[model samples]
Target: MAATSLSLQIDARWRAATTPPDRPCGMEDIETASSSVVIVRGKEADGSGFWVTPSIVMTNNHVVDHNPDLKVGKDFPATVLATDSVRDIALLSVPNVYPEPVPLRGIEEMPRLADDLYVIGHPIGRNLTVSKGIVSALTNDDYDDRQYIQTDAAISSGSSGGPVVDRCGRVVGMATQTLRGAENVGYAIAWSQLSSHMDRMLKVVEGSSPEERELTYPSDQTEVVAKYYSTLGAGELAEAYDFYSASRKARLPYESWAQGLGKTVFIRLVSVTPGDKSNSVKVHFYSTEEVNAETWEWRTGEFEGTWTLTREGGLWKMNESNIKDITKPTTSP
Candidate 1:
């Protein structure tokens, strides 16, 4: 079946608000908060959407998964504020200061299965658009102790990181994944997950002076080791090792270094496990080049590798890497 094409229309009123006056506010004051939504465009991948809070902006981890050059802060060339991948969520601080932060609904206040839900995002690179649907189900299929809010909302590629609102227009979760063979079958990371991870991420980004918080990369010595994998057409491995943490690099050199690899060794990112402030990001990439006329050969195999990263002088660097094999189902000849 042909995929559905969705488009968004840019509304100036929906842009992030710059100034919010101080005073006792009412529902009318909060209703005008639509300006907090912003469009995030990555240089290496398709543009994704995100919404803003007073101190941070939120987006999906997959959106910024491929581009290591992406950064947060006023000097950032891109439109993003900040990102966290472990939760498949990112936060961005607006360039121009805004008064009020976007309000978040408490986990206890979230909706139940089959409840009404709404989503707002820039679908298909158009403009701000709102889609409505119902909460399909609730499941713990993805992560332990964390529940996922399933919805029938029309979430597309560019819709990642957008807000999923409840009946009263309060955000209940962040839009994340979808099923391929289904219609309007989309999933969102519940607010509980966000509440669990937001504090740590905020501390890392806002704890120290802005100058003290910078992404780290591996040293020249590690780069030499990484280049070995890169020579094997493992660009993802090379890049993964470049971002490994010091301790991980020292312990599991090859495995940690190769963990960021994908199936085909292509530089495009398929998935990532964004580690905490002290840990490294586990990235999965796919090779664009085909191995043969029939079957394609992946970088490490079917499964991707895991790499470690550490912070050195405020920048994130690779520590170690290793490759693992993935098994694929056999087809009759």
Candidate 2:
């Protein structure tokens, strides 16, 4: 939809939503703004982002550090245009992106402590979910002489790069993370700290594409890939769980993921080849598993597939995988 078609009135510049204090939070404006909010998925990134320009989306840097194949919800493909590691913010170029860009307002009237906050996003990547919170505190950051919005909102894994909106659904801040071991203690990059930086990033450079950049693994992935399947076969479930990237973990739950692998008896790595993209690799393997739920008999099958791995905490972790069973019933482990 075009900017003029929007019902909610803003300044001529589309910088801010001018919602009066008396207006209730659950209004038509918010529902309309939800259409602009989109779920983002990449090999290593899974989160939410909002359009800043017609085709430019705003998300967190960690969400798309590597500009690999990215999907916006299920509607459009996207590419990273810029990233700010210090602010944990990223801008994406989504061609023919839908809805309209969220208002990028001045921080003149910044969200104060104890102010109400809300987020409308697909946190678990299922359906649009709503979370209500209050600005607990504004923590100062030495990094950029800016402040962070600390709120008691439900900012989980997939909601990391989502927009934290005000009662009027105006973009107040960007959801970054939840405090570990704390209940509902989420932190966001305050609008006061983001407005200028976001504009600067847009001006500096257009992000590189896979063909333009010679991407490389931080370390050799041979051993890491081998260890992953072998660990699963050994039933070292706890250790195997650590091999998944943050986004992969969010997409899959431990209980369900573990249950699915229960029948695995052994997996032997066969061949590992570099994929077309440096961050990805082609892997071939054979697996031996119990024949069925009622049987102890074992069977083996040959498999070939590709995997996307990312460097997380100095270790290579599986971000995504697409494996195919190429063996017949007579295949061996």
Candidate 3:
């Protein structure tokens, strides 16, 4: 579980192309691509994890199994959502929402051999860092159906569960291990091998507990309103988006929802009550916002609204948010 240093053979040609004249690509560019990565520390083991969904973080199973006190709902920073030891993958439910989730590239989307790649994680318990390399080959592993992406991306003892991203910043694999006694050689669980496991893991996350079910797939109208606003208030746009009716979300799109509410500072739930209609919930809340990222201007508003909800795919979702008025946006001088 202890951390070890690693050496990677950075492709000189690729590095030159990615790096700017004054600013090198190694530290700055890698850090930007690592926004979704988190330092996962347990009692016995510590590693890295990347946000796959608003609430879910993906890492290696061995990392969790090595930790003695880390368990679902027992840990402070995160809880176990699901694990597949055979596949060496684990999903943890984190408390804070990530600004964005790492885009998971599917098997069909695998990059070509010799393409530049980057692995981002906290190596040797250091702050998140990046190592550069090239895809050497695509090879099958001990597992019958699993495939591995061979790369020279420098990864160490603490790098397990971190992401191996393509030049375009799409996650192509999860750094799993490095060949012992070898130089600049590492192995990753390809997205092709991970996609099926991820599908099953998410289902386990939704069905594991009643609280999770209510949070992800509520049957009651009150629960739908409560969960949606709560997630939104926490800045969990992707998870909150799931609480929207498919049709409405399709029309608005996640990108627009994120941008529209980008300046939201906070949301306070005042009350939720049954509406005139059976599937609607009247919601009351107060919100604060920054007018712009550059300016210090602030505004406060109250939203009195009724959310029309409907059942879809066995979960209650809000079809629309009808805010009657903002009650005057009080600006700070």
Predictions in order: lDDT: 0.53, 0.70, 0.69
Q: Provide the TM-score for each candidate, comma-separated.
A: 0.62, 0.56, 0.51
Clash totals for all candidate models? 52, 0, 0
lDDT of 1 by residue, 1-333 (tens): 000110111123423222333654444432443354555666564434344344346778667655545533223444333344335666554433445444433333557777877776767656776788898888774433556799999998777877776654456788887899998999888876775565555544443333232332112222222333333453545554544456665676767435533234343334555444345444544345445635654222344566565556555455655545453666699
* Lowest lDDT block of 10, candidate 2: 1-10
Once superposed on the true structure, which residue ranges of model 2 sit more than 4 Å away at CA?
Answer: 1-12, 16-26, 98-108, 206-333
Could you give candidate 3's per-residue lDDT for residues 136-211 as a string of tens digits?
Answer: 9998854256788999989988889998987556678999999999999999998766766677555444443355
RMSD of each: 10.5, 14.8, 21.2
What TM-score would you give candidate 1 relative to the actual structure?
A: 0.62
| Between candidates 1 and 2, the lDDT winner | 2
- Alpha-carbon runs more than 4 Å astray in model 1: 1-33, 44-52, 67-82, 98-107, 206-212, 215-238, 244-293, 296-311, 314-316, 320-333
Better of 2 and 3 by TM-score: 2
Q: Model 2 compared with the native: what TM-score? A: 0.56
Clashing pairs for model 3 are none
